[model samples]
Target: MSDTVEGPFFHGTKADLQVGDLLTAGFRSNYRPEIVMNHVYFTALRDGAGLAAELAPGDAAPRVYVVEPTGAFEDDPNVTDRKFPGNPTRSYRSREPLRVVGEVLDWTRLTPEALQGWRDRLAALRAEDRDEIIN
Candidate 1:
């Protein structure tokens, strides 16, 4: 949403994304960070809980990264909307490849209120049958 980038940047903390979660991330090239991207969700191959430390150790652990048949939601926007570029609906996915920027959300834990709010959102995603990977 910042002027620096034209679209929204996905953000997830280390704790949010666990091993095997499905999610997407957008990466910005410019330090200023304003760009369009196509987001794709992948099955996390490794646990991201201590990703920073694992990467720092410099071993052949393959580190933290997602894997599997990558795909996107059919209805997901490939471009940023003028009104809410970074809003979840418009910005969650994009036309260009994005980096894994955040934790893959756990859809199963949706609270009643959260589920109610995102009912339409969940439908819009056109999620694949593989969503079961989260559980």
Candidate 2:
């Protein structure tokens, strides 16, 4: 991974948060609720966060918030070099808290069909027992 990454970073979630709220680690994993996450994840890409928001489990609407890291962060090892060749995802995680700065209202939303496709893919991964998260 690179030594550092620059960002006007973003985090996606179903949780309603106000500006200045601190997003910290130790929350349950969105992908696997059984595990408590050791790091808080975010992305430099706006739509990437949007996708995460869409996939987040809950009836509430997805939200993408502009954020600032309060401490050092690094590339998300789960996808950085393992899934993609490099950090094409611009994804990162931090053990420290990320402060919400603002929200993105104009982000692209997935179509119903596209959203179903992702759900189907996730189900398939679960069936194959391949939904392993590095954290």
Candidate 3:
């Protein structure tokens, strides 16, 4: 993406994710966000719904924050807050430790149709798995 720090993450609203979804969050820094990738589906934990995403590689696990309809919105840790009714603006906070990854190819600029395709692809991956959580 034009503005980003990490990779392999998806960006969207709660409607974009399902229960038992799990995937790495592509971030910018150890402090705030750079770019968000919400096109892919995940094996969601009982973790989040309003823009659900997991921390990157090194942070601890089980850290999540809920961004609801009335929640406050602010600049991403690295950028400014964006207000768009078409876009969800719920704040997500996690306390886990994870390692940040490089951003994907223009993750923030994908068209809705492209995102939908990625969503479908991710869903297909999950469907093929059947056994999601670690055994």
Candidate with the greatest TM-score versus the true structure: 2
Report the lDDT tens digits of candidate 1 across residue range 1-135. 122223222322222344445544464321113443335422222222222212222224322333332333322333335443543342233333434433333322334575345544434443532365455
* TM-score attained by model 2: 0.90
Candidate 2: tens digits of C-alpha lDDT, residues 9-110: 999999999999999999798886778999999999999999999999999999999999998888898887788767899999999899999999999999
**Which sequence of candidate numbers ranks them by TM-score, best first?**
2, 1, 3
User: Which digits, one per residue and each the tens of the lDDT, describe model 3 over residues 1-135?
Assistant: 113222222233322333334334353432124336432222112222211333222334323322121122222331124433322332233322222222222222345576467557656755665556443
- Residue ranges of candidate 3 with Cα displaced over 4 Å: 1-107, 131-135
In TM-score terms, candidate 3 sits at 0.23
Worst 10 contiguous positions by lDDT, candidate 3: 42-51
For each candidate in turn, the TM-score is 0.24, 0.90, 0.23
Which residue pairs in model 1 clash with each other? 5-34, 12-102, 25-99, 25-101, 37-94, 37-95, 37-96, 38-94, 38-96, 39-94
Q: What global local distance difference test value does model 3 have? A: 0.31
Q: Ten consecutive residues with minimal summed lDDT in candidate 2?
A: 126-135
Better of 2 and 3 by lDDT: 2
Question: Least accurate stretch of 10 residues (summed lDDT) in model 1?
Answer: 41-50
* Cα RMSD for predicted model 3: 16.3
Error of 2 at 48 (Å): 0.4
